[model samples]
Target: MIKKALKTAFPYSIPILTGFLFLGISYGIYMRALGFSAAYPIFMSMLIFAGSMEFVTASMLLGGFNPIGAALLTLMVNARHIFYGITMVSKYKNVGKKKWYLIFGMCDESFSINCSVEVPEGVDKGWFYFWVTLLNQSYWVLGATCGALLGSLVTFDSKGLEFVMTALFVVIFLDNWLKEKNYFSSLLGLGISLVCLVVFGAEKFLVPAMCMIFIVLSLARPHPEKEVA
Candidate 1:
């Protein structure tokens, strides 16, 4: 069952594998440049799993200790997962013992694929989701470990590596947009985000944008009674 599920899950994960490896390696190198040990990235990749937040965390760690501030920042940066969890509750509810890890390992890539891709007939959905999450995390861990170990030995310009995460997200968004028929949500999000960016500036726009998007999407969803009528 695991083997079969792994086979089914791997192809969906290939794009993520490529992106995570490059970004994860870049993260490790960044940590090393910050005077951190390889163990830092390895553990952070395993524990945090949120790419953007992990990068933010590197800077947080460099600064003075402030648990309350770090906690608030982490929540703000990862607030989107609240929406992801809501969307996934039904799909993941029946996954039995694997549900815990599924929730823990639900990174952006895993969520994108699992939320969108339909599982094939005869494949165990639980195992399929599990394999996808595990594989993605493994790629991140492997890349971070490699980068941290090799960071000291390598010598070259490391500028612009931070943009890898943004690039990966753009690819994911475009892929989903192409597959989707209804452009309302995409356009709405983009429009709201742009408005928020202009109004609030990049430093303060995220939370307000997320709140508005959630409210708009919730109100926009069609009612079952209306559909029945």
Candidate 2:
């Protein structure tokens, strides 16, 4: 069952494998450029596991400690997972003890593949989901570790590598845009984020953007008729 699950999950994870490896490596190099040791990347990649948040955390660490602000910032950055969890409640119901790890490791790519793919006949759904999540994270951790180790040995220009996160998000946005028919949610999010960024500036825009997003989404709940049709 596990072998079959791995085989099936591996194919679905290929795209993530490529993307995560590159982004993860870039993150590690970014941290190394900031004078952090490899331990930082390994632990953060394994534990925090939120790619964009991890990048933001690096900057926060440099800005001095503020547990309250950090906690709120982390929550705001990862607020999307609340919606992901709601959508996944039924799909994750019978997964047994694996549910804990699945929820822990349910980053964007893992959630996307696991939520969308139908497990093949005779392959256990729990195991398939577990493998997908596990493999995606493994790629990230491995890539980060490798980049950290390589960072000291090579010292070329890596100034613009920070944009890796932006490039990754753009790819994800395009993927979702191509797959879904409804643009309301996407457009609203983009518009609101842009406006907030302009008004609040980069340092303070996230909290307000999240607040606005939540308020708007709550008030704009789709009708049952449209959902069913």
**Could you tell me every candidate's TM-score relative to the true structure?**
0.88, 0.77
lDDT of 2 by residue, 1-229 (tens): 8899999999888777777877788889999889888899889999999999999999999998799999998888888788789879999999999999999999988887787777889999999999999999999998898788885675556566555455656766778788888898889889999999999998778778878988999889888688865
Residue pairs in collision within model 1 = none
lDDT of 2 at 115: 74
Candidate 2 ranges beyond 4 A from true positions: 154-229
lDDT of each: 0.89, 0.86
Q: What is candidate 1's lDDT per residue for 1-229, written digit by digit as tens?
A: 8899999999988877777877888889999999998899999999999998999999999999999999999999888899889989999978899999999998888898798888999999999999999999999999898888996676656566556556766776788899989999989988999999999998789899999999998899899788765
lDDT of 1 at 226: 82
List runs of model 1 lying over 4 Å from the truth: 155-181, 227-229
The best candidate by TM-score is: 1
Worst 10 residues of 2 by lDDT: 156-165
